[model samples]
Target: MTATTTVTTTATTSAAAAVTGVGVVLPGLNEPGGLRHGPVAGADPVDPAALIGKKGLRFKDRATQLGLCMAAAALTDAGLLGPRGLLVPGDRVGVVVSSNLGNADTVCRAVATIAEENTGALSPMDTPNASSNIIASEIAIRFGLRGPNLTVCNGVTSGLDALRWARLTLRSGRADHMVVAGVEPDNDVTRRLTGARMVDGGAAVVVSRTDAAGAAAPRVLLGPSFRTEKLPDCVAALADAVPGPAREAAAGLWLGPDPSAVPPGGETADLSGWGDCSGALGLLHCATAVAWADSGRTEPVYALLGGAGGEASGTVWIPVERAA
Candidate 1:
């Protein structure tokens, strides 16, 4: 049951990608009804039922499962649930995977097998998951999508950068629809590498041309202005590039090691619940924004992400009219 949306404002860039559907898999809030934010606890995110086809999950690893499930949820939410959510033609749909340390456990397992025996010892089924790009490849193969597939390996703001890239891809006339995912599956390897309260699931968003904004209004307008940089610098940069909306009760994000210092004139979404989802954080932030906007109690939502070395990224969300 996809909600109807309507965009009131005229197109700003005329080629920006409109976020038609958003799916977030935070184990912390895997309720039956819909995705929502909750208090932060040292816990793993639970996957939804029937998240993917049995064949798809047959030989895939946990990282693959997380990504597949999120992609399904996003596509379904977008009202594109045609034979595993491939409503558009294959080539017109692209997939971009963003992650800090994508599928580390799979890579480590391959390396260990190689060290123990030899290259021949590595399982062919396990080898594909080792590559970060496999996440995107899996989505393409699952939904019969033949569009350009890419993987972005930035830092914590990988998801944000991926969204920017997806929008650019649409503007370039590369694809009619784009699926961008930022995934971080829980595993011992990730726990050791990063001491954050790793959530087991990830997040995905269905992107299309701004003309499709009405499909899922409360549109998150991503354009050339949305970018990843440093914290205060990125915030200041966004202020210069795109000014804040004229809505009251606006929401903003100030994410980092310590996100205590809120921005000057906007509100920040609570990221305490999902823990350090790493690559998945940006999409989680987006889910929070969409949920907040579509919840009747509308407000302007802004996504602000800060990474290591003072890197930051941001996006603007306007809940013009979201279905209840």
Candidate 2:
């Protein structure tokens, strides 16, 4: 989402913010890494080293690998990963990633390894990957992104929060292009808390300022949080927020795991098919909304994310109109 002004109470921007490139790695659909989807929950481990084509990644943890794969995919899809260099200058681009459980299994195993062996045997490489913010740093290092790098470890709302931050960063001219990503891995901690095996996935999208939509790409969407409003309020806000062709889509879309968390009376997409994605669901919603808009059935689509915590994170996409 682009801002018209500084992200004050009523934010605006000189140019509209648009989602130019999108990448999503879903459960059982491993596009980044060549790992097959395991039966049921515990999928075969993904070796992202092969996907990333980097030698030093052997020591990095799974979450970090997942984050890299999604960021690379988004950059690739955006044509930013050209043979020459990044689409934008390294210093002009930023990376923001969010996750609920960051390095859970890594810390658990690190302790087990130290206990089983000793301090001398403990690997120094593993220590750096244990932090929650390592994912963004790793991506920046790999791509030489010298702009702002942020990692959010908040709960379910973290993904949305990351997107919000990216919006502000662009509005403030800190970066010309921002890659916003969200990834969640399956682990013991999440399984015990959710009582179900987590469906691991990573989703990423590139947000930038542009005057027109990419003809082959999906229209860039900008949201004013119409998704968070009540059905009546959402509908009313959407009337002003959406263009003529897509106003109805805003009124008809419903997203979230909890029915009570959102206003009633819209076509609720079945998220059960995704199993348990944990906090990555918020990013998934953003990517899905963009893809759905690409399908020509919708534009400037709106989506709402609700967690078991009963809190809602709503987002809107305002599609960039094609140049005449």
Candidate 3:
């Protein structure tokens, strides 16, 4: 018999991160009417040139290109960038990216070149993309987000973990706004590693202090809380941190990398339609919840992610008034 896992949601006392804007680069999400229904079948893949233009894309890998485009759209949506450049000082912004297989193709190819041909055979232009922090660094460098730049490579929980870090950074007064993105590229290397076709794009969001958001922008309070625990202990541990609302009121919907373990009971949605998003699913979860709240859904939603080693991470999102 297969072992089953149970998931639940509760509140925490930490300060919430306000979502000011969102952007998605997935096949269907970027298209007209795409936000209403995410990741439709046979949708066209993201055209980096179309969204962000052709300059500076030559040396960047597919994942980095997609991530840059997604971040640009999100930043533009948040009104962070103006005609000249960033409205806020470059030193006040930060970037956080999460991807399990991002740039894997570039890294693997570089390694193969070193093994088969010679170290000199590796192109200098491609060498930088092999670094683990390439995507995050590129985003910061291009957009002048000179604050704190980080990339999350944690397995399935990387997406939520990235968001958790962003919240902490804001509360600690590190940066005013955190540009968070989760991305994965459809490529031969990633496909072979995961044994499936990969999603060619990802999602992004602009999160900041509640007071920093515009008065009329659609907003939601993201948990300042994040817990990594075993499956059974997750609910109890999170529920005990801070308590006030009913379970249903706290999280009317639950989303994660693996909802199959959630049992056939509560409302749940699968991420497969987005393709093998892997680490990008958590960010997508936040974007989807924001869309729901934008459409006038009031109750909070939960995104709980469990990793391969029985470790889990989760956060709560409560929709607020448009003025919030």
Candidate 4:
């Protein structure tokens, strides 16, 4: 039996952040057809060196490299990046990353080296990656995002939580745009720690205030409702939060592992086939929804996330044409 969530709702109904662009570096997504057909087996694994070159990647962690690929694609899609640099001012943009095991391999290696050998043996090039915030900082530094930079590692909710942080940052006028990426690389350390197969790449979205977004950009609303409760009750709260007719018009996207947790709806997409994306699942869910809406789906979509730890979060995607 699934645990019940408290029906308390804590939603931020401020101006919705516009999802202007999407970037995916996951299995089968970077290929010709993209995620329109879902993850394919035997898909080409991500090659960051080939995608972004090798000049600055010698010591960077896998997660960071994947993040650059994802973020750069999204930013380029959004028309924010140019040959010279960011089209928008660097200080007007920020980065938020959600990854539970991004730097785990590096940290573990450093610790083992210190214990077995000595601190003197630590490679200077690998020292920066030992920090937990390296992935977010690296993306920001690489892209010249001088605005608020944050990283989330809060279990299952981390991915959605990173999106939440971006929304909040935009609402607070701290930045005009935010690049959000959720990445997790599969390595011996992460596999042993999580005990599940992992996806070696990530997905990203470029979100900005509706007014700040370009006129031709595709737009989707992130949320006016966010909650933490049991899967069932969390869905109930989200359904109740939307007005009568609007709630009826939305479909569902399940981002969790449990199929039974899917809320009753018109149509629902189970995204578990991407494998154990860990904290990156939330961002992946949102990015996929945006892509679908842009593909001419008229009905609004709800991306639902419920973790094993009883944390539940949801986001509403309102297509640009339907948003009014």
Candidate 5:
């Protein structure tokens, strides 16, 4: 199905982007079960344990497990049993994943082994896992996604950049289906390099063209032509432009109180994670969406990404009818 793509900028909304579905997954870690202040009056708190794997297979590395788990979770959340039956053998499926430091644990171990004076030859089996594309390649192999598969490492903006590429590819008919993923694994090097406050997680979303005739459509909505600036400026602009209720709601998720309660340009969410692996923040955003599903809220999700080059990109997604 071809979509009448539109890119508009106005005082009310920046742009209109499109998305079919989204899914989020996080690694098992010790964390508080509820939000800092507990659930909203009528809303229930999301159980972090239910979204992660407590125990499982041994051979898979942390990155691989994170990527796979997020992919599966996204598919399940989109109500797709399996793509094998739905997608044709030759159908174009694309994957765009972002990570800042890929497999630091494996690389460290390999280096350590070589440093050992009496250590034997380095393990050939461990080499491939050290590659940055390891996680992306694994997903492609498992899902048979043969279209454009890209791995971007642009710091915190990595995830948002991946999503932008996927959106454009689908709109241009480069791929009929696309999976955009953001994943990171916990490692001593990463912890030390970016400090120990960062969180490790993964999130993936299956985006496809909306079926015009379908009865049940995806709830996520996207917008085109996103604008992004520095963190402070972006926050200020959003605060001024977004409706009071929406701003309040988003602030409640990222901050302890409503956005209006704080200074207009102050940071809301804990962005320390961005310093370590900003790409993983995409997963956190996905998790927030999943947790907010019960609220019956309908709004286009705006993803803003900032990187080392002072480059920033914004993208939006809109929910549409699901395919059978």
Candidate 6:
């Protein structure tokens, strides 16, 4: 399909501070079942057996496990514990997750069951988890979220699309708090489908309305989407608009060749890995920005995310604010 661009921002940021929490979930692959600390921008390789134990989670698929793990981590990052029971009961909380290849394991198992049994009878367990909505459904059930729930599968822009949709829902007064996540599991099928070049991982972020002047809130900045075909070109545009220091501290440039090669006026702090999961890359950028802001540095932060369809998408800037 030919790529297209759509831009929408809410002029009204006064809807009871819509989102109060965010969560991310990732799956364990092989070894080192956690985030790796390095200059690479991609996810750390994880051994499923080590992280979840051999018999601990035999029934769940890789994506489901990843989704749950990231969701729990995001809740902790947002300083919330089981937000379903809290967060102004009945105050609409939405869950939006992005995945390009959804539930490959379940699909494979279902097909296998049919072949082995030599009949149309499919495994009941395999059928439910096979849908792309499984991750969204699991998130809803785990957190008791009863608002709008959606699963986006837009090539590489799924994560950013999910965030954009969640923000729109909040601004439209559809929900109060939304949990948006980008998750991908490692499987032979997904690897072949998406041209697997990096390990599997997931990340999530909570976007909510905050008073511009609130002392305890995260630095919130909004700008038009950066549209471009090349990563370096987009970074240059953002650098010109945002301050230099902020650009320097960018956790990682999502696109482009080398950080050092950036023009004289455009110097990025460091180069994280590249092209882990296209859907989750935007969330990873946001998460990195938050980490830098939390470090007490006064520099501005910008996250640049682009998709394979020659589409450039990113937030212009975000400032740090202490929560009230």
* Candidate 3, position 235, lDDT: 41
RMSD of 2: 6.1
lDDT, candidate 5, residue 159? Answer: 72
Clashes of each: 6, 9, 0, 1, 18, 21
Off by over 4 Å in 5: 1-18, 27-59, 79-90, 115-120, 211-216, 225-229, 232-277, 290-294, 299-301, 307-309, 317-324
lDDT of 2 at 79: 64
Against the true structure, candidate 4 reaches a TM-score of 0.90
Q: Report how far off residue 122 is in candidate 1 (Å).
A: 1.2
Per-residue lDDT of model 3, residues 192-245, tens digit only: 999988878878988887666432253677853556557545543443433455
Candidate 3 total steric clashes: 0
Instruction: Provide the overall lDDT of each model, using Cα atoms, as 2-decimal numbers.
Output: 0.65, 0.65, 0.77, 0.77, 0.54, 0.56
lDDT of 5 by residue, 1-324 (tens): 873323222225532233444554433321222212222343222233354444432445677767766665665555543544233332466788877765778877778888884246677767778787887887777666677888888776677667667767777777766777877766677787666634455567766555422112445544443345444444334444445454443332322123443443333444343234456665445444433433443443444555423545544333233344
TM-score for every candidate vs. truth? 0.82, 0.79, 0.88, 0.90, 0.68, 0.72
Tell me the spans in candidate 3 whose CA falls farther than 4 Å from its real position.
Answer: 1-11, 31-38, 213-218, 236-251, 257-266
Model 6 agreement with the true structure over 1-324: per-residue lDDT tens digits? 996434333332222332233343343221111223333334455444554346434566777667766765565455443444333343366688887765876787677878889545875655778887988888777667788999988765566667767777766777655677776776677767667653366676656555312112443343334546655555555555454445563433333234553444432543234335666666665555555444554455555666333665545434445655
Name the best candidate (by TM-score): 4
Candidates, ranked, TM-score: 4, 3, 1, 2, 6, 5
- What's the C-alpha lDDT at position 239 in model 1? 41
lDDT of model number 6:
0.56
Model 1 TM:
0.82
lDDT of 1 by residue, 1-324 (tens): 974332122224323566778776665554212434454356545643455546658667776777888888787777766663555567777898887766888888888988989999888877888887877888888887787788888776777777777877877888877888888876788888888667677678888876642244425555324443346555544444334453332334333324454445555445655556777777776666566655554444566666545556766555445444
Model 5 residue 99 CA deviation in Å: 1.4
- Tell me which of candidates 3 and 4 scores higher on TM-score: 4
lDDT by residue for model 2 (20-57), tens: 77776654454322221223364455557656677657
